[model samples]
Target: MAKVQVTSADKTKINTYTFFLVSRMDAGKKYYVVSELEHLTLEADSSKVSRDGQFVGKLVPESGYELPQNITIEYGSDVQKVSGNLYSSVTGEINLKASWHMLIRAKGVKASDFFVADHVKYQITSSENVAVVGTDVEDNATWTVTDCIIPATVSKDGKNYQVTELGEEAFIGCKKLKSITLPAGLTTIGERCFAGCVSTLTEMHCLNPVPAAFPQLFFHDTMEELNNSSPVYDCVLYVPAGSKAQYAQAEGWKNFGGILEDGEIIEPVVGETTDSTMTITCNAFEQATGYIVKVYEDAAKTRLKDEYQFDADGKLRSSSFSFTIKGLSAGQTYYIETMAVREGYYPTPIIISQNTIEAKTTGTATANEGVTADKPIVCVQDGEVVVRSSGEISVRIYDLSGQSIVAGKVTGYGSFQLTKGMYIVVAGDESYKVVIR
Candidate 1:
């Protein structure tokens, strides 16, 4: 698809009888003709046959058909083709028919109307700009991801579109998304864009320095599922550092929890590694818009292995959801760290040599710290809070309203009874969810 700007001046300045070539090609060599513009209206002409036996209307129209040059049919028995304009030929007194394809000002189509870039759909805003329409569920690689970032520009077919706005219900029903970051250049957000991502979302990052306008029911169903006291519940909104005050007064953003600046929220754990390649994962840093991985030549972190950190575009090297460091000597012990990346936030520098956390697998009701071990200092066992240790270990349980139900210091073993419900069991600096049913 092609995006062109047209104005009153274009009516006289541009080619009038010229054929507008707006074509698209896919990997399988299937071709399509789709064109959309701001001030221009493209109407294709597909009537007569060409000189070298090629049919007219060489390209298929967005809302019409492509017909071969000549076709013989019963004159008035089964003619079903109808268009804005029709033409027929008479061959030996037998009526011959041909179909024509033309697309006028496209106000009826949406998906095939424009183009997609970087697995996100875009609606043409102008000759030079496009707005995010929605996530491409069929082509998107981040559907199960918890954190997704919408960039300022996306490239497709050797062209780039400035993403300035987000259409209504853009991310609706994206259930796996726990957080998403909007680019700084974005000026508008539509209604229910974040719907269906309810209690799972712990944070949202809006990089726009100025608050974007929205409808009154923009977060209608979304806020109803969150724990916000007013317009938002337990969801935290992270805005730019200096723009927090402006967002505090903005209608669409003011009522969320903790409108704060960016901070460190990554917990990196090393995963499958080879001589030159490795994967670094984190335990759900909800505030992270992106991630950055750096490799070091020395364990002390003095010399950086910059070759492995960025790509040709100067962007951080990353795979889908993790960092994979390549091009290393097979047996060398190089150090690496993956930090939670955002627009204006920098996490504390991590030393791979000092990292002790292992690869994590998040679950619905487990809040474990450190390596998994069977030592029952505190655990849930069949509707009872169990605590056992060689020395005295503090054990406590709380209800939903932070009401302490069990408070005790125990040695060897101790058990507290509870009915069928949910409780937060705490032991030292670690806490785990125990549900009795």
Candidate 2:
């Protein structure tokens, strides 16, 4: 068994804690599973201050070893009423300023300290021991490596520890992860470390030149979409310069569709466009803090006409990305270019051809506030159209044949009963289509 050490940081940050659980599953062989214990605490002016010490319930033990579930916690002196998870509680979704934190414990196993970075969890077994990168506490769309640390390290109680390896099933069932950047000091990648990331993962970077040896089925599939449906999968591996041949010969590392030197930048995909706006979205570059969308008047891309910036903590937003460039002339053809800007990486230029819609000369004045296309606070209930906003709103209903079914003004909350099929409800400038069943 691997020797484990407990540090004071382990208990202090238990609300956002990370630790390892030694799960003994029937056989004498022992397995280790990383546990990220989450709990919410009330805050006074942004600092966490504790209340009473009432035990809620022990974290679902490692014997079950399931995905972490939310534990309810209360604030102030209201122990009778509790809020749900950290996100919901903090955001007032649960109508409370208090949130729950994680509680993790094992009956007979040694506990160790852990920390988190870039949404990835790391358990510290020894301050000087081999660094082991743990799995993510929650699923994410995209993830980036920590700030270019050779041995990803964390400081707690005035001491620093290195994160040097990937734990077992570190990224299993991360269906939305589209891109990743591996650390430099990593020496071992456990089995199924990148499994079930089939939906959108298309590229990754390995900073280590002669680094970790990957275990069997490092990128295997556990999700149904990849296991029984799609057979085609492609991923590009970018390694350090002059080490492409070394990685090509390494087991499991050669499975990528292509390997390249780490400095090349790829183009982003172009999405929807409007008369005055065009949406360009892309995966985050290895260490980029944000992306710059540059619009050009010509295909040469040398002349920059307009630019927009999107910042997302150095990772792609939602494993997908999108940002609109507004103020372009309508009915005009424009060239689009994207540059993923990073601290230490070269910004590569990506180009796309785009055409704006014809400018609207005269129509109902559109309101950009309150409502949005495809999502509106209006809904039909009790045979009436319920406007959810507190302000006055003008609404128009159109049928499939472009015939007007109803038009009216609603204030505070108003409703109109209408038989349903497929109808487009126009509120302000936003139009919502509904199929009444």
Candidate 3:
């Protein structure tokens, strides 16, 4: 057992804080005490604690002190004693805990270990600097790489693989990629990055322009048509839903033949009654593979009910698909429009001419004979009037006619400013007194 004392020294005064005494100790015998100290300085004066500040320290018996043994110094915190032997008459260990300015060592992380998942598929990370040179990727195999600049020197050894690039592709003949996930930061796709891959590829998510130097193999003839028409791509390009119109108008990206808006699934327009057969026709000059027709009760709220697929020859003629509308109620009105869906062509399938039709009774035979009075001939908005028949026809201006006027090829809606008035509208071999207001 031993006795120890703790103190605090101010500028000019020494204060004895605490003391403890040990028993059963001889004059020649001695003991060791371990102490830990912490300093506290006051920035402002407090009511209970002195403004002069205090020096905190702890003392513990060191009779069994050993290397790497926990020595309890304060009531809450403890310190470890590392020394091997403690002298009986040795003074207590002193720990100085104070605030001192010192520079800290810099911290860093080691480079990540990277290796290609499959030799057929190269893997590149954001920090990689190597070039990928390998065999042609299998058609279904997926090649994933990210955040690396793949120089033009790299070449794809094989075909029909999926090549995802987070950066620009400066190389040529990487066409084996059947599908690609373009990086948002991508700025350009070098020429032929996807050349000779058209047949194997089903889609391309291009975020930037197809480099001008790239060969036509990168895209089909239909995709190249975007330069003259809209920025429509040749293949099915899936974009963020609801961005069809925006993407359709993007520079060098328009003319996506079939721009499907978000959440919209393009299917063939199936007639309501499975028993009722309908014919779908298109006037597209190019050959198409499928035809999509939309059936709607109201023009504004339209949806796809059915889709008709066809072979290449279907594009040249009126391709007909018949479906019986089994449960459709007779006399219900419906609208129909058709378009062409073909491979290597875009803005697909063409938007077929649309019209309204009515369902008839199952056993009844109905024929569309001719135009009746109720459905009079009318001019379409922004459309010109042309007379195909060459026969004597009577025509008169609604408000400016005294005698009967003759009718021929009349254009511009027949008047500059059509106001609400009674007009005598006549055509070859027929006459109809009409009123325009």
* lDDT, each prediction: 0.49, 0.48, 0.33
Better of 2 and 3 by lDDT: 2
lDDT of 2 by residue, 2-71 (tens): 2222333452234332122233432232222122343322221211221221122223223322222122
Model 3: worst 10 consecutive residues (lDDT sum):
100-109
Candidate 1 vs candidate 3, TM-score winner: 1
- Error of model 3, residue 246, in angstroms: 3.7
lDDT winner? 1
- The worst-scoring run of ten residues by lDDT in candidate 2 lies at 352-361
Kindly list the per-residue Cα lDDT of model 1 for residues 71-121, writing each as its tens digit.
Answer: 222222443321211311111011112212222121223333356655566
> TM-score per candidate, in order?
0.37, 0.36, 0.29
Runs in model 2 lying further than 4 Å from the true structure: 1-112, 130-151, 222-233, 265-437
> In candidate 1, what residue range of length 10 has the lowest lDDT sum?
87-96
TM-score of 3: 0.29
Clash totals in order: 5, 11, 43
1-437 in candidate 3: lDDT tens per residue?
Answer: 32333344441222233222223333332222223222211111112121122222322222332111112222224333221122110122323221111111111111221123233323232332222222223332233422123232223332222333321122223444545544333443333344334444545454333312223323433335424543234545545444555766664445434443322222222222222343322233233455554555554635544444445453245433343333333344445554446544443244322233322222233522111112222221122222212122333333346554433343212332344444455553344343332
Q: Higher-TM-score candidate among 2 and 3?
A: 2
